[model samples]
Target: MYDCIEAIKQRKLKKIEGETFLVSEKHILKARNGDEYVGLKLKDKTGIIDAKIWNNLLHLKDRFEAGDFVKIKGESNYYNDNWQVIIKDLERLDEKEVDKSAFLPSTKRDINKLQEELLGLIDSVKHTGLKKVLEEVFLKDDFLERFSKAPAAKTMHHAYVGGLIEHTVSVGKIASELAKDYDGVDRDLLVSCALLHDIGKVYELDATTFNYTTEGKLIGHIIIGYTIVQNVIERLNVLSQEKKLNLLHCILAHHGEYEYGSPKKPKTREAVLINMIDMMDSRMQPVLDAKIDDSTGWSEMIKIIGKSIYAPKKAPKELL
Candidate 1:
């Protein structure tokens, strides 16, 4: 079986096997010979590469769709400075043969450690009502299992298993630290908001395949989170009028702006703080994911970074 990186280098040309990755583009085209060609963005844990079928083959289109695991045989070549594969054969593989963990990109942080740290912050909240609400929701048997395994996004930042917990914990830590320096922001409220801002993601994405559901696409995480939080508050019957309004406002405004998916602008100081912290974590994901080995000066093309160039400042010769 050929791995993704080896296939890209053309070192394993005889037979290549790996899972098919459906990126943004999946379409059919007519080749120069007037035959229909199928294109694919095949990927595995290491990375992705461009691939194409030279001619229409038997039941090829129906057999494999984007996000499906398949064993492929292809010869590799270079095209316009990027690796391309000419697929000669393909077959769908059993779910057991394909490890889902190997396909999804994951956060560099530890999920368990992050969860513990976040819980510590939650326990420190001075407000009894807010703390109890957060603990009741997160510490439950059923919610904990799903929250710890869910993806933060369908394709954006932290779009892997256990990503939701990682992102929420990271943002919570940052928001907590920021609260110490700023006045008029309740530290407990901010911390609770950070921990719960993306809770809707657990419902938004399908845990089995880590893809968006129809409800996620239509209502979005913001509205879904609001609904979930409101229901929990009603059930608990412990939050004060002011606390309920403040917490709800934070959830609604965590996305920052209506154009950014937030239904309302941040009305409370804690909500504003959570919005900023959330933005920082989301934007930094691509930068962290694009890192290469220390020995290699050249890294993969960061599609998100685009044409804008950033040069790391040169260190002194002694330091090197």
Candidate 2:
């Protein structure tokens, strides 16, 4: 067993020596006095910590990259309510020497249960062409395996292992229920889109580390997922041009705004529903996981959502 990041606290353990932390982020910053220092974000299975290298920086500066495992001589401290490490000496560790599992965070939910639910949704698509397209799409190559394990984003919501599959299945179930109440909505198409709206994330993110690749940064998961869907439609010849176009439109417009990277706005009922569900899933997740602050009765401000969420003092009387 390894020492967990959450266990090393400034108010508790106080100091540790010669600990290994994965280098998730690395950069150089110029100080006010014209001195340069290395800035880093170190991570482990529990969480991440801001770290700094202030001594003998030049000799070890080029030895490591963002993804490498580095052993460090450091002292941990709490500063402004956050933990950061001041590294005294460090050396890059080889991939084989480091235990990769220690650094990756995993979803707590059961993966098998999630996949079973997803397969059920895939079966629920009533459109013959769309069903066939989806079957051929998932069954081909090793796409299913990769999709089962990918994260929904590099950071922010659902960044841990198996997050993509969990989010997809959970949202698909919700969208399926929501579509049943609306007359014009196509539940089958909406469910299919819900299942696949973020499939591109499998290709967009680094499979093991959950970081964006160069292609992921440049092309983004939306276009990459769109391209994947377009290729499936071309080779399988399963759907009519209109169905294909609408499906592609849902994927492209799911982001809901031009500024947010959607190429077009949702035009069809199914597309709109898909957008709503995707947004609902991505936004709700972080808030649900946000920790409560006892003093202020609010969670720490979430930069992505731009506000701290308030934690209610007591459970509802209805629930009680």
Candidate 3:
């Protein structure tokens, strides 16, 4: 049996042998001297760690692909202030030889509770047409099951089993709470959009493998979700044209900006609210999940936020 990835500490040049990991990403790159090396992101339930194979790139290149389970012998080293493995040997493992559950990460929250909260949020929508459409889309097939299991993202916020529902419920609660304080805000529309914004991720990410599907990579979650919700709206013929467009717009613009992959910038109040809530949650999750550095009183640099976070070991007594 292999030890968990989290067992390796930062700055510790520890030796690891006969350990297995799921290759989440792989890259082949050239050094300044024109030598090639392999870069990888390896994961196994506890956490993910960066790794590199500095030599024999050509011989090891064909041994495995991203998403495959591989057995490795390596030594751990601190690079860029993060723990990483310098791989010496690697071999791909047969699926039958490994327990898939050991390699997949899962949410710590209760899946059933999150599912129930999401269903309650959907039921809270007073708009008859919107409620019917949601029911038709989520309750008709195996979608609810898949959605409950799907990760909200590949590596960003909520990238684990049951992550979709957890994020949806959290977003829904935030939207509803904020709607109550803001006059002229359509609470129903805002809440509905929050609950359904990332629904396409159910199909976009492979729930088990945690990799983007062909359609997910080509079309993306926003367009995929827009199409999914739009189809339901059209098929039911229950919503007014204006309401239908507003709902779809919220999903299309939740990414907030065009450069952020949102095809449409948020035009309506509800769209703007969803976009803000989505961005807030996505940014906060990584900081909240990171392990603080004991020496620097800071977190490793978060690529999404573009800086390291300060989380000192000792807090002010007053605050504590």
TM-score, model 2 to reference: 0.88
Candidate 3 deviant stretches above 4 angstroms: 1-3, 9-13, 316-320
Local distance difference test, each candidate = 0.74, 0.80, 0.86
Model 1 Cα lDDT, one tens digit per residue, 50-99: 78887546657667776667776667775664567787777877767756
lDDT of 1: 0.74
Error of 3 at 242 (Å): 1.0
Task: Name the lDDT value of residue 238 in candidate 1.
Answer: 81
Candidate 3 TM-score versus the reference: 0.94
Q: How well does candidate 3 score on lDDT at residue 163?
A: 82
lDDT of 3 by residue, 143-246 (tens): 89888889998877788788888888899999989999999889999998998899999888987667899999999999999999999998999999999999
- After TM-score superposition, the amount by which residue 136's alpha carbon in candidate 1 deviates from its true location, in angstroms, is 1.8
Instruction: Compute the lDDT of residue 294 as modeled in candidate 3.
Output: 73
Model 3, poorest ten-residue lDDT window? 4-13
List all candidate RMSDs to the true structure: 4.1, 3.0, 1.8
| Poorest stretch of ten by lDDT in candidate 1 | 304-313
> Lowest-scoring 10 consecutive residues by lDDT in candidate 2?
1-10
Check candidate 1 and list the clashing pairs.
Answer: none
